[model samples]
Target chain A: MTETAVTRPTEIEWHGVSPKYIAVDLIGTAVSALIFTAAATVPYWLIQEPWALIPSAAVLLVHLVVLVLTPRRIRSIRYALRADDLLVRRGIMFTRLVAVPYGRMQLVDVNRGPIARAFGLSELKFVTAAASSNILLPGLPAEEADDLRDRLVALAESRRTGL
Target chain B: MTEPLPPRSDTQRPEEREGLGSPLTEGRGADLAGPLPAGNPRTEGAGFEAQQPQPLQSLATAPLTTSLADGEWHRLHPATPLLRGGIALIAIVGFLITNLRDRFIEGFLPMYRDEDYSGDPVEFLVGEGLLFWALLATLGVVLVVVFFFWLSWRFHTFRITAEIVEVRQGVLMRTNRRARLDRIQGVHIQRPFFARLFGAAKLEIEQAGDDANVQLSYLRGHEADALRRDVLALASGAQRAAAAAAPAAPNGVPGLVEARVQELLAPELDPAEAAAESVVRITPGRLIGSVLLSSGTLSVLAVLAGLGIVSLVTGEPIAVFGALPALLGLGTYLVNRITSGLRYSVAGTRDGLRVGYGLLSTTNDTLPPGRVHSVQLSQGLLWRPFGWWAIRVNRASRSSTNAQQQQTRSLVLPVGTLDDAVRVLELMLPGFDAATVQRAAAAKGGEPDDPFTNSPRRARVLRWFSRRRNGFALLPDVVALRRGWLWRELVLVPLPRVQSVAIRRGPLLRALRLAGVHVHTVAGPISSAIGALDDADAQRFFDEVATGAVRAAGNDSSHRWRSAEAAS
Candidate 1:
């Protein structure tokens, strides 16, 4: 039995990610991609056919596409914390968003790898009791990450304490 | 003239409480057996207020949390250690004795013919009284086990303090686990074959916090039952602590003291559960019929028939043998499903609901108020004719790997009629409106013209095979996703339990102008996929679900007792 018509939700103001994080991810991917481009030469060396260049060219083309698209992919990864839930949106094509409620958050952690440490950035992770609900917001400024983490911990504590 | 009860703890002698708490635990725990609805108090609230002390003042009841108080620490039955260690002891002793005979045959006897030897080692050992040494070693092994058993029995103790259920165990690394009484969700009493014979059982007191479940085992059957009631009574009494402040029943608070004494302290299982009407037991015919009617059963039969045909045509006859792996794989899955769902029964209890199932290994889990986070009612392809629905819920588990696997752990009713499914759904979700739920369950076709927004006919070409069944139904507390044509599945995620919501438009879907609202829950079989909704419908559903989840989560408070204390 339908009764009340609900109002539309306000537009989500997404916070863009730190660019240095993208540069670091690009360097690693580019390095591995270069190795693949180099490895593709093996078939050309052994087969000694002009057609083999087509295969080698394809690998280089894939690497080129990745080099071009990697930055855009990073730019697409955005997160926003609302009044009661944390919303993360990523992927340009598939476009996925997870709105994790503050009350449902069981654990929140900030992790920094060596590259992220050099870049002064870290990943903020929210762990909920649900198996599928774990959300990782990557490539955030270390300070921003820690601040968000503390706020998340505080909000989760307050909301959960309502029981 | 009468003073208001001082939360039960301030007035009663500790000795009297200890007497009422454990003595009735032996057998007839009928009084304390009713489930406590907590702050959602009705008749029992006043009764609980009178008999039990407030949870906060539980700290005032006991002065020390250090070394066990003389009477405070209750050891598991002395034979508990023996029960745990005896099997290992027997096996080790048996192995050593058997090893001696084997050694005599292989090492000693073979030495005469000489396979391999290092200067008659066996003969030298024999001369040094090998039999005596062997016997001594066996005795030493037995003695060590006996010593450890005694140490474990002596040190391990469980006690219900004013505010917490404390369990302390271990000889060297002593662990004191205290479960906050107010946070206690449920208690499970497991009676294993060996323990049941000795009239002993194990109590697992479930709390909301991780690894916070208090497990104490091998208690005399009666004592175990009483301790379970004791914990529940104190937990429920925590809510009524405020009611205890008033001289007479104040503002709709029921008889908490009388409820605690007569309903919780009296010895007997919950009377409500004992009545046959409260239970839905699976019959043998139903069990067999469900398995035979299952899609899995049909697929297996189809595969076998195909293999048989292939074997006949080819005449190699090895085709049947080649498909053994697939046959075995499906066999295990079929067996697992049947056994897991076999002999299942869901019963209503004072606290909430108790679900027991398993053909070979059974689990009797008690789910108290508000433990379930989400629920799903699904109809499989084959079971549609039978009007059977499988009701599964997402309850926070102890520890799990991922989401989908965890959903199966919270299975409330594996397979049941429409009525049984509704009854269980009501049990778990107290706030869910029954009328809406019934309407949703009875929904045959979720059409654009009907109640729900149907997928555009273009989706018919996209999902040409299973186009008819893909639709969604929105409720106040839950968002229902119905999918699949032959093996249909209905996934329901409570707004509050929604970890996140995703509006995904695949390249194909984007072209069709359809976006799916993918509601992610803890990994489980219940995947809420409200797919093929038009762009506007999808966007609206996503936004509304996101907001709904936020509102529901905000309304739920984890600590009601704390609020009650603040209010008072």
Candidate 2:
């Protein structure tokens, strides 16, 4: 006897992300700036000239601008999951659409950095079969990210069982 | 007849069908039955077995014989020699650097008359303690070399098992890594000049893991090839067995290794027959002219002239010019051109199209339809008059480096018409319509769809000598533009592969509503360019490419197989 197809409820869903993404970005920027400042100190002290200062000042200004711009950019980021694919859209002026099919997913890695832990958020990195590319959903709430990861894993397993 | 026991249902009698389904049943069943005589005393006395013994009777009645199996699992090639060599090279360089520092302080300081020794205690120390430092430095170099050799001996271990290949390495922080046989994509055997002379080839296995690639240091040339074939067979066999077990998978999925191999290497046109299909033949004069006109040849000549002048002034022996380096460069170039000319043949066949070209190191690279990743046609200003375009294909390989090596196997064609390029692309990418490609080639002018198009967003800044001289900037934005006589023109920014992109604007460009954008891929011998563009447009393009990159990153299906579905 042929088995009939079973009707399963929608398994994939999108939950809202954590709000501490700004903090992570700021920390990364500050660390970068600190390293740059340290590296520049030697040359700055050696040259002791206004001309040398121009280059350093320009670099610092660029870094500051990037640091400021990142948070604003993060504010526009959003993600969604349909039955078959995951979608991520971000960018203010130039919109980007990224869709990842579930069948292609290799593994899901959930990571929590020191800052992320302090802020009670986690990051979900979905690695596809391709060696070079990974889709990272950052600034996710710790419990929420874990739950979503479990759901995705379960869906993948169910799909494997011909459900 | 005695009431026949109800015939056992097919569902309950799996053992009866087992022999019927298996091809090995005849041979294996004979072996099993031969040991047990057909007329057993116990069975004959019973006349009819009171009841058929339980299916598990074989296990319960079989005598236990324990003898250790003789065959040991095969081991992977040891990577120690290569690792040691690399470590030694690093150590030697480090030693040389330290020696150079010591020599500068001890040997050069005393000879320098410009420094006043009485005023400078540092100079005095260098002059007096030169001998002491030299002896100590020599000892240090010897010790470092000895230590490296010692470490090489202590820390290398590699083993290939039936199911996995294992590597155990590192001295202080030991790392043990294992790659399952089923996960191995392909084994690449590489033999550099020295390695070939030593009869050793390096084996690299591309696997789907964090390390990406695993390398075996050295194996005998023939042995390496044998090992490669064995590994490939095992991997493919396992894949096939898995697929056979679950036959519903998609066609392109993991289990279709055999299918992929067939599709990739299928022969369309025989190279021997296609040799006669060449329409455009290269004359000796053209070959010579091409060699002379090439940038590589010109650079070699320039270097030779510079070296000749230096030798003349220095009164060094000019006979040294006849040595191997000078001859190799010129000889290889000439031979390369001639071979390229000889192999200039493109022909179509049922399987696909074939283009073979090369000289001293002749190479034939086959591309089957539907396997091509991307195709690009390039033309330059000089080639515009001749109406020629160069075609290139990007194909996926398990090992990126090996794929690159294979791509360099031959310059498929030095020069071909735009139509020829389209013809080749059509076969390589089946869905790529010739008409569409031709249309894209023809629509070159106006606002081209090329991502590198010159836009109003680009900054046009000319550097003035001393801020007074009316000369273009010394930092020339080298844009290589090529227009085929028959087809479209291609503009190359020569920006390398663009690893990162940085947007910068100087006061002048900022005032002019322009910005300088630097796209960094991989830095080769050539310097990357900063394309001057309108600030907004440059930013927009940069953002778009970045977004595209993100999208591409999200959909990495490099190892995805259509067959996964079928198997599942």
Task: Give the per-residue lDDT digits (tens) of candidate 2, residues B209-254.
Answer: 2234566666644455445544443333223343223212123443
Q: Provide DockQ values for all models, in the order shown.
A: 0.25, 0.08
Candidate 2, position A36, lDDT = 82
lDDT of 1 at B344: 71
Which tens-of-lDDT digit does each residue in B137-174 have in candidate 1?
Answer: 86898798788888778777666665556555676655
For model 2, what is the C-alpha lDDT against the true structure?
Answer: 0.45
Q: On a 0 to 1 TM-score scale, where does candidate 2 land against the true structure?
A: 0.45
Lowest summed lDDT across 10 adjacent residues in model 2 chain B is found at: B2-11
* Candidate 2 stretches greater than 4 Å from native: A1-16, A38-60, A63-67, A93-96, A105-107, A127-134, A150-163, B1-371, B398-414, B442-568
